[model samples]
Target chain A: MRWNYLIAGATAAIVGSTSGHATTYMTPAQARVAMFPSAASFIDRNVVLTPQQRSVVQKIAGIPVRAPKIMAWEAVDAAGKRLGWVIVDRVLGKHEFVTFALALDAGGAIKGIEVLDYRETYGDQIRNLKWRAQFTGKRHGATLQLDKDIKNISGATLSCRHVTDGVKRLLATYDAVLSDHG
Target chain B: MVLSDCLPPMMPSFQIMGELERRCRPLLGTFVEITAPHEKAIAAGFATIVKVQSLLSAHDPVSELSAVNRLGHRRSVTVDPWTAEVLQRALFWAEASCGAFDPTLGGLMAARGLLARNDSLLPLDPQANWRDVHVTNREVWLDRPLRLDLGGIAKGFAVDCAIDAMRAVGVQCGLVNAGGDIKGFGPEAWPVTIAMPGSREPLAMVELQNAALATSAGHDASGGLDMRHLAGASPAIASVTVEAASAMDTDALTKILVSATLKSVVCLGLAGASALTIFVDGRVIPFELKEPTA
Candidate 1:
């Protein structure tokens, strides 16, 4: 249940951010505590899937397993009673990377999900001064502010389809691997 | 030793600066991001958005909006004050635009497979329009069986509510963006970029100060524009971006401009909003209302 390493890793990740678009919403430890406030302990139950297990997961999830390793934690109460499980996973958005934590209750139903990090890979192109200069003082007659980062965008809404699909895959992971665990 | 060597090494500071905090979560079928100076403010903002979604989401059968849709034709369904307020605004825009921005198109959207159809609900009346909806106090009643989808304006209302939540927490400046609908308020201007429909290409950049901005695009599958929410919209227009004092107005105005009837200009003037429309042929038009003479 010690969370020193988790705090350290989170600090390192935040300090390493050079791009403005990458946002870290919560540390792994923070997310665990938020998802399971009553848990007395969190046991690291990270899994490494066998080839057969991977295929099973892919079949159940209807999505290809991108990796064999999965980061997971098992929550236990003060009386050593099993509470739930938390699975950390990553999925690619259309032009971004989303890292999220999906929590499942003891009955294998989804408790909640939280986004840990969101990084827009396309952010750099818009930040380019040359690319932005083309629209400067254009026919739109709106004042173009060039020096600031494109922190907010107003355009067609982007669906959270990737994250939803990622949740489905993680749920299948639960049904395939963690469902039978003690 | 050089002058720089005599001084300390000019390395970038690695310490965390406690000035700004940003968070993003999936809500209202899209990612809602909030940026504020304090963590509590951001949390409050997201909490408010969650409440609004629970009350107004048509996708959730247990929500008040779904309840109204399921039984409004038969009985007066009571809704939360916030839901009633948004419904009132929707009616206002619907009236101003002369059916160009109808909220009763939910039946058409369901028929088109844009929204899930509930078999248990009463049969929809194709003749139902915004005029069929009646709102008095917190009660909403439909003159006929018409599914009401607030998808066109609810996100903006959520954004506005989130901003108010942030302000309640003593947040001086903050921004709330639900998908592409955004509102920012503070002393300094928030810089935002406008992307082309279905692409990340930068179309324009504008500074929003204590204002709201929203963009609506035509049916472009690749662009991720859910044109199903719009009624009688012209597909020839690529996109329309509106700016107003409130996010709800901006959000509804974008849809009004996309439909583009003669009354839309009057709606823009009455709402104190302006719009920028990008045509499919790459023509950009700005609609600025003339000042009324005293």
Candidate 2:
């Protein structure tokens, strides 16, 4: 479409309203979600999941999609080691917009995941269905560096990182909430 | 010969050539017609053409064109085949520029006040695209709204054209030296010095034959590096050299080679010319004219 482009390059600062929500989580997003829940809901009311994992979380919460942004629960076992779970929500930075559910288990491991929505623009990053299968049998709380541990598709660096960023936020939140609760 | 006829009565034998030696203004924005005796001498004289081509330098932001129906929509005003030749050779420089040497930057040039004869300048419509211009052998069409200025490559092309015009005017042995874009015709033994600083003391002098040679470099009178064109292309090179079927090819090739590096050099070689590239590291990559494989 050869539409007219009348827009000039703008230099104004857009003061984000969500700055108040970002707080003391290890990740910027955790800071965001903790400091400003009311504003956080404006953007990240979503997460990423896989098929087998989707049904796992959905069966637990009964159609996980409609669950109001959970102020999810967390805690470690008697050993006091790194272990707990939180169902935090995040979105991908990929041009491909795929949103879904992600769940961590009691040992702070990946319990399951299920994609609620998916569409792609280019090479499959999470869509080739590797995210769930790779996490299977893997312990929870593993650092989610997709390039090192997960076989993220090539030419899909940002897309792959988007999913991992989501996972990192979820884990950090679990760490935060579980430490406080325990 | 008395100097009073055209000069002060105190000077010795002289007319046109002597006056020219005393003052050689940068030959830009002026049309030149050479009137010299002897063919090989005229062909060898193109070393002077090299000097004039350097003055067209100004900052024009755009990916310098490599070839085409036209460099960009702004260039649709004329065929500028000579410009097309230089743009094609300047690929090396384009590689250095990372896209700054673009001929497609007609809009940017207009904004920068670098477009010569820009009195009728009008801001391009927002919808203007480089691809809008259509060109053919007979005419070039600038559809809708597009303004192109070939200020970058025009001097080199004029240099080359002047060389050809020199030959047609019965110059049996001479050179067209448009500052640095030089072409030699007739005889194979005139001495030429490629006086680029730091290359060597003798400056890589060559025996001029039926060949074209261009070296990309110059210094202002104060010895300050005049890098206006070379920097425009952003090549990883301080200089570039090109030898082709014609002087025009060699002249513009230096600019293209400054930034466009691999893409443009390969393009020149593909189009049947002998080309070589000198990197900033002093590494030289040479190309031989050959029929290209798909």
Candidate 3:
């Protein structure tokens, strides 16, 4: 019995070192780099929309900008070349919150998208690789509606719609805020 | 380009106090959201969470928990005040649940490859019950060589600590959600939803007024593993969501209700928590919370 226990412990120790716990896939900093591989540094920028900008953002995105101001990061490469923009945003899923990174290029097109953290116990089908891939290279000015533009997951309606709406808001914010800055 | 003339400076009747000031950071292997009335409160809340994570994380090699797991059997190891508080609560639940919520299963979990080992000797016999672990004041002593995994309840305790930090900074109206183990406070009740497995709709929508809610479901609830299996939880349970005055209680109770045997149900009922337990066959049981009478 002791020998069996020893063997089991040794096998588990080997497996544990290589695998990570389910919840943590990537940290914010790691997600920033993964989203913009060409970028060498990320310049942290915070934006408090003016009344006019907020109104336009809400009108364009068709969603309320929860806070008066928001935060984003500018990914810059060596010699000060701009790579893209990284925006960390949250959306209410079926339950709890779904947080992701909206990586938009200089031309206001989505470069990549990654789920940073998911809080809901179910309906995480939004994190499916195929679903996320459809958003890549989509431009901000386009009508990026949930079912109208991005395909919805079968049993993850709220997560799909809310995440799509969040992306739309990110794009509108990009056009209103970072388009000129970049 | 400055459209300041055409727009109002700010919306009228928009109370400044009602404005949500929020921040997020990666801690305790998940995203920690701290929403408060001021940046000071948010900063303090995040700091408190990080402090608790470092002290109690079983995976961290330098954590006090790791040290205790390594040498507590040799001598009574002095732990942080917060660690002691959490451990005391854990022990209570462990006994209350009749070993269903055992913390001493850390080594068993490690041996089963659920959690990483932290340089502690694995129990050969593997039945290192919670009763064997002892705590007094700020010291913890283990009767035998067994690791203690606080992964089940540490996050909730950290959330409560964050709430405390917010109150310390005079921020009353806010919510702290550490990977969906949420505690909400203030005059207004916070709306919470528990998602139904394999469906888009929610199983329940509850309001938390200065309260906490925690959900423990099958790993496959989100197309994942059976996480409760690691804790020796009953295979019949599909999910359990508990709401209580404290996140610590709710967190620990979810595990207990899902895993405890039928005989332990009476004691669990006397503990005074409202819960919804969904069995694997779609049967739902709701226990309305009763306030403890003085």
Candidate 4:
């Protein structure tokens, strides 16, 4: 029922982020200067999580602790098993909103993923159950090709591209974090 | 006091739906008119439905059939006459449809995790297997305990019962429509319309005089699991309707018609019902009623 302190903090940073209680939000400046500086400009870009989404996540987290609004996530699985927890971040893109989640297993494999939320209207139907299922057994070595590796729904091309791109970027961020922590 | 004891009157017609549901819980389609509506015949007619429903339900705590279905891999079990009879017809339909109209599909539906619990919470794993359900006289045993989902066929059976109940009431003309599958017995001739599977517009209508008509369309508003029952099917077709002598015949025939070539339409006539098959293309294949046998 209780997680270790480090996992709890990371989980709180990821899961309880943007929850009801008001705390210091990672401003564009703070997010740009402090975290993922390589992708700061991209990470600190426009990000909006609907209250409905925040509510759903809060209910799922079942935690009442206060935490800052985070735009970058890094979930850790201390004991490699099932999907431990997911880290989500809203990265602004050239055309649309790109919210993505990075799921880590106990052994640091990307157990599951979600293009958590996206607004690339065209050809994005891939994420709606059919497309999300493709990443079920995906690991770090899984190819991230938009055209060949990931199949896009015909009508939602923009969405398919954005998701595949977001996944690749999240993996880059995960790699940078893992090397640092290790 | 009798009909009122078991059911509330939703309409002035015979309580066909109530009868089927009470008799067969986990029943697929419980609301289809088998009996014609007469103000005076309501009591006698509805009472028959109630009795039948009680006989069909698998709710008894210690019923031999329920035990087999709930706890399978059994040797043998004794079945009541009515349950045995219904199972007999179901077996016949399963064979006739060449596995299209299977009562054994409940297990498969459960395994698909398609079953919604009584509390409406979906099970973590609900992949059903038809092989799990085993049927023998008096015993509805299974290879394993899997969830049973009776979606299409149950509605058809209820409609058939409604038709019989209407005939017993001495009312000559009646129509029983469960969700969508309909069966009618017109005093002279019943004019039935077949709707285009997806579109609300009427594609074609016919007069069913001396027999029953059942229409099955694989069409769903959302179109979830259509071609799942077919061999190498991709759920491309919209809906398929078949007219048969009995509602069960029509219900089971629809599945066969979807996979069948033009050659199979003749077998519909052999099964004893006039044929009017419609596809998503708007082409209608019509057949006259067949010569009666068994």
DockQ metric, candidate 2 = 0.00
Residues A85-113 of candidate 1 have per-residue lDDT tens digits of 99999998766788989888988888878
> What lDDT does each candidate get?
0.76, 0.39, 0.65, 0.40
- B1-294 per-residue lDDT for model 1 (tens digits): 011212222221212224667778888888898989987898899899999999998888899999999889999998899999999999999998887887887878888776789888888888889999999878999999989999899999999999999999997789899988999888776767676665444455566778899998732444334566577778677789888888998888888889878987788777677777877655556666666211
Compose the digit string of candidate 2's lDDT tens values, residues B60-79: 22222222223333454343
lDDT tens digits, residue span B191-217, model 3: 454543333223334556688877776
Clashes, model 4: 35
Best candidate per DockQ, number?
A: 1
RMSD of each predicted structure: 9.9, 29.4, 17.9, 23.1
Model 3 spans with C-alpha error above 4 angstroms = A1-182, B1-18, B119-125, B198-201, B220-225, B228-230, B263-271, B289-294
- Choose the strongest candidate by lDDT: 1
* Candidate 4, superposed: residue stretches over 4 Å from native: A1-182, B1-37, B40-67, B111-114, B117-137, B142-150, B219-236, B261-270, B287-294
Docking tier of model 4: it is: incorrect
Provide backbone clash counts, one per model: 1, 78, 0, 35
**Best TM-score among the predictions, by candidate number:** 1
lDDT of 3 by residue, A50-160 (tens): 998898889999999877667689999987888888888877744446677888887789876656765543333432223223323321111211111111011111214
